[model samples]
Target chain A: AQSVTQLDSHVSVSEGTPVLLRCNYSSSYSPSLFWYVQHPNKGLQLLLKYTSAATLVKGINGFEAEFKKSETSFHLTKPSAHMSDAAEYFCVVSVFNDYKLSFGAGTTVTVRA
Target chain B: GAGVSQSPRYKVAKRGQDVALRCDPISGHVSLFWYQQALGQGPEFLTYFQNEAQLDKSGLPSDRFFAERPEGSVSTLKIQRTQQEDSAVYLCASYWREDNNEQFFGPGTRLTVL
Candidate 1:
């Protein structure tokens, strides 16, 4: 019953510009939200997670995400883009008391020099 | 010390051949997971294990896919009669019970069935 939708399949941003990758979710209960990043030929790395705590969550590499329950959205953002930030990003939602996660299709970020 | 580890970083199997993949979780981790990721897509859960118990396998595609974590330390996923559709990256993840859903993933095995 829980699912996540990533709005953009691909996003391009110039270096030093702000970046936004939108995601939305549907869950029957209060859910745990997460953002993960995967580089080419690498494993997924956790960027951040929200477990009913503060609405705004900060993550590694100057990345952050805001959890908006009203909008059913948890969109990831960064103040400035860097070349190393280019990767595939996934939005995930996990139901309360459940260990399994439903992942979005993913957003590919490309940072331009 | 070490994060999750998976064997056979890449494999190419002929159709109808059986293949086995391996995973070694972090020391003393209580949960292990397997997922399949197609090209240009997010990873999809294939199965889950808590300790040595196979708790959930609802995401496995068919009866030909089998997974086991016999001693609670290492796990193996076996696929019988490989098909072209089965070609994808297989990922393994694990985390400690106290970590509260923080799953660390290994570099996945890229399987290509021809």
Candidate 2:
């Protein structure tokens, strides 16, 4: 079984400030990691993915995540927060390229003006 | 290019009522998936379909749930005897077997079982 843990339920940051959302994963075997963003009443949008190609992965909207195998963490970070970034984010994992996705509880982001 | 689309963006059903949700995947996408997202929680996989074939449905909560993709493009998920616990947003995503493993998603159908 594979699962992901989002360390924060809600994160509030000021505009133009760096944003950080923590996530960790546990899997019995090799897995693929993904970060998806969901605006209110919207579908999940892929932010970035880690297929073991690079330790550090960059995504759209100035967001990025690092795959730390030893720490079992894949934390998402953005150089600057945008008001539009206020939404829910999920950390997902699929065991060994399996299509089935196991998502984290989700972290709600709030960007203050 | 159109992404995945779901009908009845919002649905309200009384307990014991049956509901059917539709999903129209991106053209040429060979795989489709269903997921359920409860309030304050992330989405959970419900089933998977490849073309007109259902390869796996292990995530379906119970026999009350049924899905089909007869023509290999449009798919439907049917829930019988809906209960209060079934109130959630039903999400549909489609993927192409080739290229990256990314799945395009739809806005989803929010089912409220009152």
Q: What share of the true interface contacts does each candidate keep?
A: 0.71, 0.76
Interface RMSD, Å, model 1: 1.7
Model 1 clashing-pair count: 0
- Residues A3-110 of candidate 2 have per-residue lDDT tens digits of 999999999999999999999999998879999999998999999999879999999989999999999999999999999999999999987658899999999999
TM for candidate 2 is: 0.98
The residue ranges of model 1 lying beyond 4 angstroms of the native Cα positions read: none
Report how closely model 2 matches the true complex, as a DockQ value. Answer: 0.72
Mark the regions of model 2 whose C-alpha exceeds 4 Å error after superposition: none
The lowest-lDDT stretch of 10 consecutive residues in candidate 2 chain A is A93-102
